[model samples]
Target: MLLKYIISHTRLNESSVKNTIKLLNEDCTVPFISRYRKEATGNLDEVQIGDIVKYKEQFEILEKRKIAILKALEEQNVLTQELKQKIESCIDLITLEDLYLPYKKKRKTKAETARKNGLEPLAKIIMSQKANDIESIAYKYINKEIKNVDDALEGARHIISEWINERTDIRNSLRNQLERHAQISTKVVKTKAKDEKAQKFRDYFDWSESLQRIPSHRLLAILRAEKEGFIRVKINIDDVRALERIDNRIIRSNNTCADQIELAISDAYKRLLFPSLSNEALSKAKEKADEAAITVFAKNLKQLLLGSPIGEKRVLAIDPGFKTGCKLVCLNAQGGLEHNETIYPHPPKNDSFAAIKKIASLAEAYKIEAIAIGNGTASRETEALVKKIQFKNNIQVFVVSEAGASIYSASKIARDEFPNYDVTVRGSVSIGRRLQDPLAELVKIDAKSIGVGQYQHDVDQNKLQKELDVVVENCVNAVGVNINTASIPLLSSVSGIGPKLAENIFNYRNKYGVFKSRKDIKKVPRLGDKAFEQGAAFLRIKDAKNPLDDSSVHPESYKVVEEMAKDEGVTLGELIGNEKILQKINLKKYETQTIGLLTLQDIIKELKKPGLDIRESAKVFSFNQNIKSITDLHTGQLLPGIVNNITAFGCFVDIGIKESGLIHVSNLSDEFVKDVNEHVHLHEQIIVKVLEVDVSRKRIQLKLHKK
Candidate 1:
């Protein structure tokens, strides 16, 4: 029954969802199931598999709640057969809670006090609309506690109010009304009007918009403003209209009993129903906003992690600065720090000639093929200095983003790697490695600190972390990892290799040289057969005895490749990377009950290009040398820029200035660009036309150049 419900909800094939859930129950990771168990899952991708996992967990939670509710009802002696059937059949939490609300234990409310005064029969008479003279009926219940007819009727009205509040149909109707018609409004705190810290939220100080239509970013901003006590927020619908809908449902006639019921309905809506439904509406809207924000953050993190890499090269990296001189480091091809120094070329201590001579000597001495300059303070001036130097070898200079370099520098990972070096030297090394391989270096820093997300801190932290972790895992597996050189963090993101095993692998490598083959990974402590089965395919080995081990081809499929080689009358090495030989082989012949056509097809592709880095190589980008700051930008001036950050509204471009420019969605292209990523990507270099510049606000607007 649960499987059928999940299939209906996700619109997925029943067989596939069933098989996927079975595999998930067996402790298979998403990457493993999506990549290796494709035949079982009918070729479901990671996203689909992830959805199945999420929904299965959600349904399990719901079932547990139902069990607890049933047990509670039984303990209270209120579990009728009909009530049990209704609870068992209910699928949604809201309706289940609505049914359970009246039975729930509560404090001594006014209604409970009235029942204690022996007015239950009078309240029931009024609710039935059968009492013509409520005063006489009420006077009969009057005693020492209930003094007069007025007091008795008032007590009965309180009991009726609780009845209206507990009615499931009435609560559901009011909830629907609030969700459809509620509006969110914010007002600035008068005392905080002149505070400098509150100035950032000026635009949201007097904002009002339909709760359903407010954009995720705007809503998050308003919520943050409210959180910081700069503004007060409220969500409300038309009270009179909501009350009328409730009245129509409760009122059957216009007699005295009906008049008393009307009073109860008004009291119920004002004191109980409105607050409950309005809060529920706001909670639901916030949840939607959080999901949207987390999605954006996940997308941006994926693009940034999978950005172009420059491959292996000896590099000279500079952490640019003014008063503190430019911190420099020379990294080997494998990104190991060979040497470190400082150059005071910018200001305060302007030793230009000395800095130039030292840089030239270092380039020759270290054979630096490329120079990576941090795009931070004094970045443009430092780039100019590096460009002016006449080098012995052809060297390309790139301005790499230094968003989380400072954070990483002070982190424990940095301290462990470079205990003798200060933050500046460590930061320079990070800039260099980021150019060599973005995915390997970026996994060291937290995704939130990468500075590419939209309101990352304002969203749900746990959900954001989970989504970002999935993206990192997908990217790491998509581009296979080098088992010999991958950091503990990067290796931890692989299929089944978590932090403890990652540490073991790293420690094993450090103690017993580099990993000679994928099989050697088993020798690491606590890495069992299951871990190897899930992780071996994604971990690549260079110059291994088995050529397939160096590629993404799993070790279990080595026999299949040997068979293909034998059929072709060639050696394994000869059969690898020979497209002519690969194309001649029939994949159907190798398919076994365990291995399907999908896995065989993937093997053939891997044999075509053994251990290919799918990511594009980084290209040299040059900004408009004349434009250094926002003051130098002019409207209509065309300049080269790199897309730095993307949001729902638009993309932010780094035009080699301290302040990045925004290209609003409308200005992204001449045609309608529904998705920003469809037009531009993170770290993509493009030419843009400056539209406007606001010096006071430090905002620059630009448009994508047509040509």
Candidate 2:
């Protein structure tokens, strides 16, 4: 039953989804199932598997709600056989709630009071559409409390209003009308018009747009403004059309009873239905907007995490500053901090000769192969100063992005790693290590603080955190982790090793030297077979006893590889990377009940490049020498830039200036660019033509260069 629902919702093959669910229910992780059980899942990727898991969870929640509702209805003695069946057949939460609303218990209302006063008989007479004298019927029910015909008729109308509000067809029709035609508008708060903080929301002060057509970012902005008390937001629809739709569903005749019913319809819509449905629509819209924003954030984070690394190079990193001296740290090829110092290369000090002497001496003394300067405060000056130093050994200089360096400096992770050092020293080390391996170092910091998102804080925090964690997990596993050298945070991102297990593994490594083989992980306390099965493939061990340990080949599949090497008349090491022998072996011959052609093919590929880093090597980038700030930019001049952040509307490029330039979607290519990632990526360097520059506002506009 659940399989059909998921297949219908996702429009995927039923058989594949069924098998994927089976694997998931067996306690297999998404990464493990997608990578190892490819044949069973029909080669579905992690995204499809994730969707299946999400929808299954949603259905489980709905089922639980249904059980609770059934229990409530049964307790109230209103659970008829037909109503029970109708509730069980419901597939949508909104429709199910609408069906159950009439039976729900509530506080004392005007309708309930009227019913208590013996006016329900008159309401039923009016609803019958056969009563020609509603006033007479209402007068018959009038008691000492009811003064006149008008008072009695008003009581009947109130009862009828509740009836109209509870009718399923009337509620559904009115809801559909509002969803299709509602417009959201905002107005500035009159009293706070002159406030400076409120002025930032000026764009939304007089904004009005169709709720259905509003973009996610704009909706979030207006909602944020409303939340901050800068503006009042309202959702409106054409009242005449809305009333006509409700009246058509409720009124059956033009008699005296129909007149009272018309009044009841208007009261129901204005007082009860419209407000409730409009709020529901707005809540749904907000959820969709949050999902869209979170998806974009997840994509940007994946790119940033998988960014190219400069790999294992001895680096002298500088955290540039003007007031305090520039914090410098010298790191070895293994990313361990060897030395740290402070140098004043800019501002009041102007100690150029001394700074140059110190840098050159460090390069020669530490055998530094590259220089990584944090792109902050005095970055340009530091880059220029470093470029002039004449080192005996060749050194490549790169200005690395320090988006979350400050956050990481003060984080508990940094404090634990560098107990003796201060924040400045820790920050320099993060900058240098990011250049060496972006994925490993970035896992230690929060994904939101990386600054590659739009309105990140406004989105759902739990959803954002979950999506970003998935991206981090996938990237960490894709690149594979060297268990011996990886940090606890990096190890925690592996497929099956969570925070607790990661701590255990770290402690085990500390107690007993380095992990000698993939199987050695099992010896750690609390590390069970299931954890080893899920994580062993993604963990690498260099110089292990078994050559396959360093590759992505699972230990369970080691026998197949051993058999292949035996058939090829060569040792496992000789058979690895030997294309002639690997190609000569028939993959189908090794297939068994558990293994298929897909898994066997992956094994062959892994043998070719044992434990290869899937990411590209980082390259040094130079910005346009003439431009350093917004004031230096001119219209129509072509300049080199690197894409710093991307959004649905456009991409922001860093053109060697403090202020990044915007490349709107329309100008991304000669053809219409639907997805910005298709044209550029995070940290991608490209040439752009400057189109406009607003120095006062500090905004630059540019167009992508045509191929």
Candidate 3:
């Protein structure tokens, strides 16, 4: 399998790949692996393992689906062993589905019943085109069983026609050709309903376009428009044109009967082949939608994983709501919330000034370097109010994504953190901490609540959630954490450190003392040797017992590194950070295929800059006080936005508005899109322009350019 090949070729270890396959088979969650299995996986973090697991799963699914299709064909007595083997060898689902096209179940057709009667030979005679007399063949089958001329012709045609269509290989060939050549057509027509509701599909009137060129967002929109009775959709493909090749074959293969066979082939295709093939193209388009959607989601995650962080700074965060006012939490440099408050700035609009006054006072007293504003209801208004106050220089304001703030606010972790406060306070703390450490804060909430992907709820939740969790785990492990300061929740995502071990680590810290070195982590209760192996590299001990121990160097490979450093006549720390010197090490000297060239290469890279955080440096983003309402939007004005959600169509970016604007997938980039995610993703700050604004529906269409 390609997945196995990739695992073998990549720098990622073989045991990690094997364990991922096993864990995926057992349906153990990504969080489970990242949190629990350290040593067994060589402390391979969630992201790398997740990537492997996902690829393995996709390969497995494609393989099994192929088998299922082959079994179905076998049941119909249409599958040969050679054909079965060929199907099994297929790699992609598209190819597998194409192979199964003819054997697929469908409504009962005239062809099957016609074969039950005795008119097959007469049908063959007409189809043979060898018939010097068409009436003579028709006469032979004219009886009560074969019935009249109409019945006899119908029965004969049905039998011969079905046999011709049963050539699954030809069906497979034609489907591929048709999908590439097809066009989708749609029309909007009036329906019976109240006012404009009935005319929902009226926008698609007279739309016609190539299927290949259609954007995912537009396709999903049109499908939805049709579903709402706003349009009638149809897909057009040159199936007859595609089958022309097959027709020529039948005619060329059987010379004397060529003309008759050609006619029969044409009739068979015209009556049955074209419609089925066109529909098949439509089905394939939908599959493309799913693949596109997943691809976009993956891109969104990539961006989110790469999102910048607000370096060690005290931040005052506010979670705005209707009845709840603004929940405020002040988080220290280590992401521990030092204080909480709920000050009403709107609704009970009388006390709005007081809330702003308190925010400024707290900022001054705490020496807060940043103000993290949650992008939720009343958020814009609250931000506008806060901007009115004069803060000391360098206290930046950030409109943070408050996605899943409520979920974390209501979680047990939140409760434990603020047992004496309200849920709103917990939510505020979550918002503040999210800006400080997204991966850390996010892990405390359910992956689904992060709200980064499209149709997330509608898709197979089990699969989607699992994949998303894996994405999160991979992101978390890619960037190591400070064990001394990390919350138990954050520690839980470390490879080999599950919830139980996270608790143990923290508990051990609370009892014995804070760990001053990476080696001391093994002493944490329930942290087995296997767990230590996977967890240690990703858990940094700044100012630890050994400087190299604080780096990403795995403990198992410590000796090799020490030996290399010794040969270089330098300490491990000096050798590790010496990029020029480290690059010269010979791979053969590593002397083990178990740790291949790829692994050696990764090690060398890490040695140059150990404990490298994959995240980008944070930027200061402030909400515009003057433009607080949708009505304030100008046609070509450029604005900053945080990508809140991504769909196959495009990214939904919140620009401090009540509702986010849609940057149509078509507007995503100048490049032709096989995947939307390649251009943009979640939590990414992007520039956009207001293309169209509809106040009535609260809809704002946006384009991705600095207009």
lDDT tens per residue, model 3, 320-389: 7767577888888887778877888788555877887899889988889988888888877777777788
lDDT by residue for model 1 over 360-460, one digit each (tens)? 99999999999999999999999999999999889999999999999999999999999999988999999999999999999999989999988888888
- Candidate 3, after superposition: displacement of residue 463 in Å? 6.5
The global Cα lDDT (0 to 1) of model 2 is 0.90
Can you tell me which runs of candidate 3 are displaced by over 4 Å?
1-109, 121-146, 192-202, 238-272, 360-369, 388-394, 410-422, 445-467, 483-535, 541-543, 564-609, 635-655, 659-707
Alpha carbon deviation, residue 233, candidate 3 (Å): 1.6
Give the runs in model 2 whose Cα sits over 4 Å from its true position. none
**Candidate with best lDDT:** 1
Model 3 residue 412 lDDT score: 87
Q: Which lDDT values do the candidates have, in the order given?
A: 0.91, 0.90, 0.73
Q: Count the backbone clashes (under 3 Å) in each candidate.
A: 0, 0, 12
Per-residue lDDT tens digits for candidate 2, residues 544-575, read 99899899888889999999999888999998
Candidate 1 residue spans exceeding 4 A from truth: none
TM-score on alpha carbons, each prediction: 0.97, 0.97, 0.76
Q: How many backbone collisions does model 1 have?
A: 0
The model with the greater TM-score, 2 or 3, is 2
